[model samples]
Target: MTEQLLPENVQTWAQAPLPTAPPEPTPAGRLTIASVPAGHPYVRGISGADDGVVRLRDPLPDPADPDRWWPPVVLDAAWITQNADVVDVVHVHFGAESLPPGRLAGALDALDAAGLPLVYTAHDLTNPQLADQAPHEADLDLLISRASAVITLTDGAADEIARRWDRTAVVIPHPAIVAEGATPPPGRATGAFTVGVHLRDIRPGIDAVGSVRTLLAGLTDLRAAGVAAAGRVVVNDRVRDSDALDAVAALLTDRPDCVLVRRPRVADPELEQEVADLDVALLPYRHGTHSGWVELCHDLGVPVVGPRVGYAHEQHPDEFTAFEPDDGVSLARAVLAALARGTRPGSGERAALVQRRALARVVQHRAIVRAHTDVYRTVVRRTGASA
Candidate 1:
């Protein structure tokens, strides 16, 4: 039999090369970056002190809500004009979904007037939070057309960007979410496999009801086959009042085999423990580009079953199993395939692997940070030379 070849994007991720040379300093002794939402884990993972780049703290639009950074203040033309002296370049990763095309264009015009180059990371080609795709596409059209450089996490996304806007984007792998040397929880007792489906607040991109039902169906089939299996559904307390939550509850009614967990949004440590306790994590995204959840599960050494919609599979091809979105049978097969790969490592092996992966992430993170620095320097230089 002929060996099946992996997709081009999968191969690209598998063979992605890392930069070893030390990064050069910025033309300015130290460059300050105005990351739209600097508090996000992905943004923090790709930034470091040694890269000659400092990301400014996210502006507080609402004083009462300190954690909120939506409708990023730096995207405002007025904010950019006032802070132009301190911020060398604007690197927008998220929060543009909250802005209309006209406002985002005005912000880009401001950056042009101030000679501040824009480096946009296409994190979400299709905004997962919104039901409609047109608004997000409009935002992408403006941002990509005006950006001095573009960055994306997966090669698949890069290809899409090139095809859509005729622009090339630098591909950088997502860094580990769990901190270095972070240990995964001990593996669960043998003979019982747990499948987890976290429908946190049922975002527009997530098929919460469908995912839960599919998990229930899959678990039922597994049990009928004499393979011990259980399903767990996790949802945020904030979604309790929503119709999606009601639908999910109705599905779980009288299902003695499935357990439903409800809680507020959790911090990293809590989340890590939660995911580490499961045998497999199910990603229920109906439509979106890429996922940090996949990265989180990888960091915890837990296998993930994700939809084939985006580059989630490409993110970690070995650890990820793909199923068609909203298809129960496909999900069942994917779950079975994932569990059949064998139990996650024992405690000692898990600890050692986590340490080794952590060390590797440190190195890869440096490369990611260096890549951002290089983009910043290149854009700044081009802007200065033209001036």
Candidate 2:
């Protein structure tokens, strides 16, 4: 079959040779998780900082370029070949983020060759709305047949995978990591309402040239509607070209407080603190479900003001004030209202009630690890392979 060409934004990479494996151990009960990128926010939320149920390993570094999810994921060849029995169950974390074609194929093929029981956790694959959906879906189906159990970030995502693959996914949305005893950042005297768009997933079609046009149009309507506020658009990699970014910068150059801070994933915690300092946060997303961005805001107790698309509603906390996607005007209104009448951390009664609600629906860390453990055990049982 001819290889499908990637979008202008995506690219390919060389496949690393599979890792060499040790002889099978009949007496061991270990499981190996094939994480695409270690320390990814999703992984961190799911694994909850590695508590003793399954061994996790990845070829990628802790802080790889967050925006560049395309290809060259840590030499997987060295991984599968070298660390075959590193775990009893071979749970491969697969998603539609981005990767080299041959690299993904090689990883699955190697696992098959090793006679390992495979489990795939689908994060965001099969969403045809994504730019590279065709290839992503093809790879997902190819990998699905080998899956012992499918884990997904949202119930909707799981259902979609099941419908496409004809197999059920164990629904396991990523958990929020509570920052215990941490105080919110100091409020800015003259704040710039922040809208954190981790611009990696944002396509060039909505650049400053285009997105700014949308925002400006929205702002005009918002000002007319008497609900406009001054704020900076916080970004990590919103623009693909420096010139495009410069144009975006120029749009804000006249504003006294408009700022752009190039933040690495490692620096995101501090960045979030800065974002929390703002009165309101915006997603301004065009498409897709299950946002790590929204969850981050909720965990930080930062109120969100985003479009009613994808998983942005997951952050609404209720039915009111959810803005429609791509509407700068409505989004601006949501932001203005939250900023103008500052949100109080729920009063003591509300806080306690919220905690109880959180506890009731809590996705415990142990539960997440145990879910993987069960998948491992099930895979081992099904494959009847020597551990």
Candidate 3:
């Protein structure tokens, strides 16, 4: 197939060799980064450091809906062209969900014309919101091909990026989402095995109902086989579809071992508590890329049972359980395996584990921040030399 030419104004490095290894640049004054949607947990976690290496600009509210911080102000070509004088670097994290290819290309052109480099953290290779991968792939084709530097969460993701785009990306670990000094919820009843399933505004990638049914079935099977004397599955969902909501409630109605909790929405505190409260958290995503939720679970010493999609298994083999996606039986067997391992620790031991995990997160997040700071400095230095 003949390669279609980009519009006259669009700039791309698709044919260029992989970027050369960058020399470590010396850090100086605070670098102002215009990170799209700076309020996201991942972005905030990485940038939340006392060391003044990077200062991120707060994302402007959405023009259409003033309550949200999406469709970031920096995404506008006019905004970038106007604000480029102040933004040292434009780092894109999560606000590319709506941009078409031509518009994304225009944003890149604006950044280039203004002499501002772009640093894109490839959070999602396949956008969770979209059912189709083509549009997202096209968007990445332009963005990844032109980004001055690209960052991703896992080595597996980086390898995939290299294979797909012929571009090299730095692998930076995801930072902790839970705040430091967070207290895990009070332990469950002694000798009780409990798992949590959260269906918060289900995404296209997730099969929430199927996953919940699988969990209930798995727990029921485990109990019947004497693998466990008693087991519980706690489900949390918000005020959404009335019928879907009723179905969940009805499924658990007769099953005394299973309980469904309906709330308006999951606030941050509740989210943290939910992680701490679960002996295990079940993830039902059949297809997707990476996860901040899994990291959050890890931060609180909660093990996750995610599907065998994306790099979740590769990200932390020992810490997570991967089951064949779309197979309720496979998911049931995986949960049973987790139960067969052993009972959760007592309060004293649990406290110690929580402390250890929390401390590890602190060190990991700081290191991640330093690594990103290095990347920013390197990109700025290279941009300066090229100009």
* Model 2 lDDT, full chain set: 0.53
User: Which tens-of-lDDT digit does each residue in 285-311 have in candidate 2?
Assistant: 555555556655555455666555444
- The lDDT leader among the candidates is 1
Mark the regions of model 2 whose C-alpha exceeds 4 Å error after superposition.
Answer: 1-30, 48-52, 60-82, 94-100, 126-130, 177-211, 217-222, 225-228, 237-239, 253-266, 315-321, 336-363
TM-score of each candidate structure, all chains considered together: 0.88, 0.72, 0.84
Error of 3 at 278 (Å): 1.7
Residue pairs clashing in model 3 are none
Pick the TM-score winner. 1
Give per-residue lDDT, candidate 3, residue 335. 70
**Clash pairs (backbone) in predicted model 1:** none
For candidate 1, the lDDT comes to 0.77
- Compared with the true structure, model 1 gives a TM-score of 0.88
Which ranking of candidates, highest lDDT first? Answer: 1, 3, 2
Worst 10 residues of 3 by lDDT: 1-10
